[model samples]
Target: MRILILTHRVPFPQNGGYPIVVGNTIKGLVSMGHEVSLISINVKKHSGRQHERDDLLNKISYTEYGIDTHISVLEVFSNLFTRNPYNINKYYDAGFEKLVLQNIKDNHYDVVQLEGLFVGPYVAAIRKNTTAKLIYRAHNIEHQVWHRLAHQKNDPFKKWYLNLLARRVKKYELELLNQFDGIAVFTGEDKNAMESFGAEIPLCVVPIGVDMGKYQPEPDKTECPSLFFLGSLDWLPNREGIEWFIENFHKEIVDGDLKVKFYVAGNSIPEDFDEYDVPDKVFIQGEVDDALEFVNSKSIMIVPLLSGGGMRVKIVEGMAMKKCIISTTIGAEGINFAHGDNIIIANNAGEFYDALKRCIADEWYCREIGENARKLVEQEHDVNKVTRDLVAFYQSVI
Candidate 1:
């Protein structure tokens, strides 16, 4: 099978989030004797990192177009006069559109997969140019993230603006539903959500899988009673979750009877994050060199997300490394995890604090949960198995 993957960013380095899923998927498909080609839009922030995976890049046909996706106040104001969603319209580039058309004309592809909702703007052009089976690989329902953030905001003006964006996004999302030949979502929950929104096209749940060979658990190196939060700190939901945890539960945990340390590690830590008055036990280690090593060294992984959609990749990575995880219901969404069994569910500050205390007090219980987490990922999220399932789905759609 010859596959073409179009994405909004260079899915290499696999440092965090969707890139890990996308990069792994391409490699998995290539290893299974399928020809893969990639067309990616690279922004200034996430560009120039593809060199880290030159070996992977050499295995497949890859092309990238640079674009400025930074938000501008003037552009936002101008968008109000038009019916097009400001968020979706910004990703539409005439040059990129032409490039996509030329790419399709040069080669024949069995499937052209749009990696996320942001790339939906390219559907009409691809449909017009090629007879390939178009697949929309939805990372999440885009509008729901904004909708949740809008409801969380207390300020009147901010809330109104967010709500407006959410409304525009929802309309755009619904409009693109039937444009694709098939839809592949990361979770069953996402598939059901799309169905609720009147997506009657062929849809399948294909969760992101981790490469087990690279993420083996090291139980002996685990730092007992230590808690860590790792993700892209520049993202609103991540920054919001961390700040909420620090404001409500950090002090109590530090001052409590148990001696524990909290570590924060990720890329792009914001300047304002330093303003929080946290204890010495709270170490803000921004953008570590090796993510897997960092995860293996930690005892417990904390995901305090209050809002967001799709699956949390960090939680899955932590689980694969045999670390006990405590997350909110929203944080643990998409993954089939059981509270107090494979993972600990903590919706509020009280529940989070209690879970933290329990993990700190009982070493045996913490290790047991970590072991269960590892088993879950091995059984469900191995990369080879997931890629095979995804290929089968593509064959069925064709």
Candidate 2:
């Protein structure tokens, strides 16, 4: 099978969630004996980094087009008058459109997979220029994330703008449902949501997977009784959730005489993000050398995602590393785990505090939860298994 994968961001480095998904999926496809090619956009952030993937760089061909991904005052104001969603409009480039059309004409592929909604705008060009089957990989119900953020926003202007964008995104997403031959979603819940919105095409639930052999737990290295949160801090959901945690729960937990320390680690921490009072207890360690090693060093993983959709790759990686994870209902949206069995669900501040305290007090129960979490990922989310299943789905669709 020959496949062409298109993404809005370069998938190398695999530092963030989207990159991890794109990188692993491509590697999986290649491992299954498929000839895969990649066409990705190179933004300012990923500009200077090395795009080296030993297993993939030598095997597959790739192209990276430069684009501007900055958010400016002019762009925001200009979006107010446009009918297209701001998120979609910001990523659409004439050069990228022409390149995609040219690629399709030059090298015919069996399937042209759009990584997410951001790349959906080029579907018209693919449909017109090629005979390949179109596959729209719905990372999440794109509009729902904006909708959730709008409700959570306090500022009137921001809330109104978010609501407008959400409506436009929902409209655009629905139109693309019938435009593609098949849709691949990150979870069954997402598939159901799309079907409810009148998506009638062939759909498959392709969950985000992890390399199990690479993510085994290291018990001796873990910092027991410590809680940590790891993700891209520059993202809206991560920033908001952390701010909320500090405002509502952090001080209480620190003052309660609990012997628990909190750690925050990720890329792109903002310049003015000083929400916490005590810097010692809540350590802000930005950009670690090894994410998997950093994760293994922690006892508990906190995923307080107040907004956003799709399965978080960090949570899946955490599960694979045998870490006891505490996440909000929205945070653990797609993963199939019972609350007390594999993971802990905490929505509000009070529940979060209580869960933390419980884990601190009962080491045995925490260890049991972590053990179950690792077992679940090994059985269901191994990368090889996921890729084999995905190939079968592709064959069926073909």
TM-score of each: 0.96, 0.96
lDDT of each: 0.88, 0.86
Model 1 backbone overlap count: 0
The lDDT, on a scale of 0 to 1, for candidate 2 is 0.86
Question: How many steric overlaps are in each model, in order?
Answer: 0, 0
TM for candidate 1 is 0.96
**lDDT by residue (tens digit), candidate 2, 1-398:** 99999999888788889989988898888887899999999887768756456566677889989999787899778888889787886788999899988888899799999999999888887898998889999888889988998999999998999899999999998988999989888898899999999988899998888788788788999988888889998677888887787677676657765578888888887655545536557777777879999999989889999999989898999998888999999999899989999999999987987898898888788889999998998888888988888888888888
- Candidate 1 lDDT score relative to the true structure: 0.88
Error of 2 at 252 (Å): 2.8
What C-alpha lDDT, on a 0 to 100 scale, does residue 88 get in candidate 1? Answer: 77
- 247, model 1: CA deviation in Å? 1.4
Model 2: which ten-residue window has the lowest total lDDT? 271-280
